[model samples]
Target: MDKHHSKYQITQLSAGEEYSIELYPKDEVVKAKYIGQGKLEGFGNQHLFISEGKDKNYIAMNDYWLRKKDDGILTYAPISSFSTLRINKSGLGEMLDSENVHYKNLGLRIIRFLESFGEKFD
Candidate 1:
């Protein structure tokens, strides 16, 4: 858990795979579709950025493109920047260096902790 990424809620979509801003809305797969990829910007604390089966057309501080699959394949990107981002193994339930976590309720953190699920919404 790093200082920068741990501040926001990470929408971990997959267990073994890592998704980064570099490969998200601007990836080759996305650009191949529209000959351009949308940009994510001008937002902060963008939580639950994108849901399953939905299109990624908006930018937020904390957001996701979409649930790629039921196997947890979500990618996360930090807002407030217009530069390249480093790909790391940050996830939803990762503790923030084990010190700053006291700021957030431990119980709530546990409640928010989920291993995996088939559906992305109700």
Candidate 2:
């Protein structure tokens, strides 16, 4: 995902890594790598995502109940369960290598994931 802007270089994403996405607008959107499966607690302003377990501190990103709209928008909603998903690392790598890549939702997800993993494109 190595993206180069006028003054900053974009972070690079790797294959098969789990990440967290921010629900708000900010310079940094992705939260963390998601060490283990986290449980959603509270609601609205009291909502909190907690990651903790005996053997695992967190779970994979896909395992979280995420809602994707018909317009290709993804967001977290009130769901009973979350499913395990897979990321296309090779395809993502190819997109990063090309100059035709559009850094929209998917691109941003990859960038944030890389940033969480401490990858520096700068």
Candidate 3:
């Protein structure tokens, strides 16, 4: 992973790599395994990842709001019905919005996982 200030270009995550993510607030972290790049039914091409637990949860790539630009910059947009989470300047995750709890939680987990790889938000 290449770190540029608070921004990170994640070039280290490989297929089948296992990582942990916080699935819910005050809940135990869950294990997620990267299934590599593939096309999601309605989301086109995206990175596939799945979480392991009592029940299998498939996290769609489209749930991610932070995107890497061509200029190697990290940008964010509210892709879901709400903008519920954010990574603060300190590189810690914080919940800023609360309209959609489910998607927000998943987004938070994904962002934090990316942050572990050195990615950041504005």
Candidate 4:
């Protein structure tokens, strides 16, 4: 794990590997598969994509930024700021970061999903 964010660690995903992800707050968990890393457009940054049926979402390997708000809420800026996040090899993750209410709620949902799989976050 990165020293600055010892609580978070990222396990690289393999192509075609299937996993579960919590994409929305209070929503049912969805099945997802690693699609691979690449850029959608010539000028875009390289990123990894996961497919949940017909829906595809990108996970930015780098440039995933986050911070804590004054009210102790977590906030994140996907491609703009800094923080640490890791999804373990067993498909578990811990994120101590996000501020916008929507993103904060979404983060909590993800944490709950990971907890369901036996992962815990501080």
Candidate 5:
């Protein structure tokens, strides 16, 4: 098993409810999607991200190759500015590398996780 394979619990925050942030093995192909309303909402092929870690190379990366199916694909709005953001009352620790697109991959995973909750609510 991968070192990061342990199951995690999502914490609730002012921004949104935290859901488990678990990473699947590269062999697994998890479907990603946006949380929408009504019949218009459902799961769809999407991307996911993996944090490269901090230090010399300050940027997370997408473990899998993600390609848009078509112009019809859905793109969720960017969440936090940083790939690994932990918002607390003390202050915000956000590291947004505007020149880097790896952060966007993190967004996709968040969106997918959110959609899972939406299904339960509905």
Candidate 6:
């Protein structure tokens, strides 16, 4: 996998490869792409999920996960299914209301997960 870095860092993962992303400040827009041959599986059986907000604050974007099928690869990104759960468990919406954009409870979980794998976004 070729690794590149700028405002964001890039790494290529192989098929059935799993990775997590957590952006800092909770307001920064982030993007990701999978390079080379392989399948990329993301959180919640999905490749994308936006955090809790009445309006769109951040957009979680990533390359669609791909798998080999009949000598070809099919790609798709599942919808986010965690937003409502996060709001219910931690009152994430209320927490977001308090902070300008620092970090929230559930947000920290994502950050920690990404950091656990030595990934960071600013």
* Residue-pair clashes per candidate: 6, 5, 0, 7, 3, 1
lDDT per residue for candidate 5 within 1-122, as digits (tens), equals: 33232222121112232122322332222222222221112223222222222321111112122112223221112212222222121111121323345554444443344344442212
The global C-alpha lDDT for each of the candidates, from Candidate 1 onward, is 0.29, 0.35, 0.44, 0.39, 0.25, 0.33
**Segments of candidate 1 deviating more than 4 angstroms:** 1-47, 50-79, 82-90, 102-122
Instruction: State, as a TM-score between 0 and 1, how close model 5 is to the true structure.
Output: 0.20
Model 5 worst lDDT window (10 residues): 55-64
Model 2: how far is 100 from its true place, Å? 4.7
Per-prediction TM-score to the true structure, in the order listed: 0.19, 0.26, 0.38, 0.33, 0.20, 0.26
Over the stretch 1-122, how does candidate 2's per-residue lDDT look in tens digits? 12212222222333344444434333223333433222322111111222223321222334334444333333444322233222344444555666664634454455455445453433
The best-first sequence of candidates by lDDT reads 3, 4, 2, 6, 1, 5
Worst 10 residues of 1 by lDDT: 28-37
Cand. 3 TM to true fold: 0.38
- Please report, as a residue range, the 10-residue window in candidate 2 with the lowest summed lDDT: 41-50
| lDDT (10s digit) by residue, model 6, range 14-44 | 5233333333335222223322221122234
| Deviation from native of the Cα of residue 46 in model 5, angstroms | 19
Clashing pairs in 5: 10-18, 10-19, 52-60
TM-score of predicted structure 6: 0.26
lDDT (Cα) of model 6: 0.33
> Residue 89, candidate 4: how far off, in angstroms?
30
Deviation from native of the Cα of residue 1 in model 6, angstroms: 32
Q: Write the per-residue lDDT of candidate 1 for residues 9-94, one digit (tens) a residue.
A: 54434333324332444452211111112232332223222211234221222334222223333333342233322211232234
Alpha carbon lDDT of residue 11, candidate 1?
47
Give me the candidate number with maximum lDDT. Answer: 3
- TM-score rank, highest first? 3, 4, 6, 2, 5, 1
lDDT of 4 by residue, 21-96 (tens): 4332343344555454443222233324344343333333332333233332233333232222234322322223
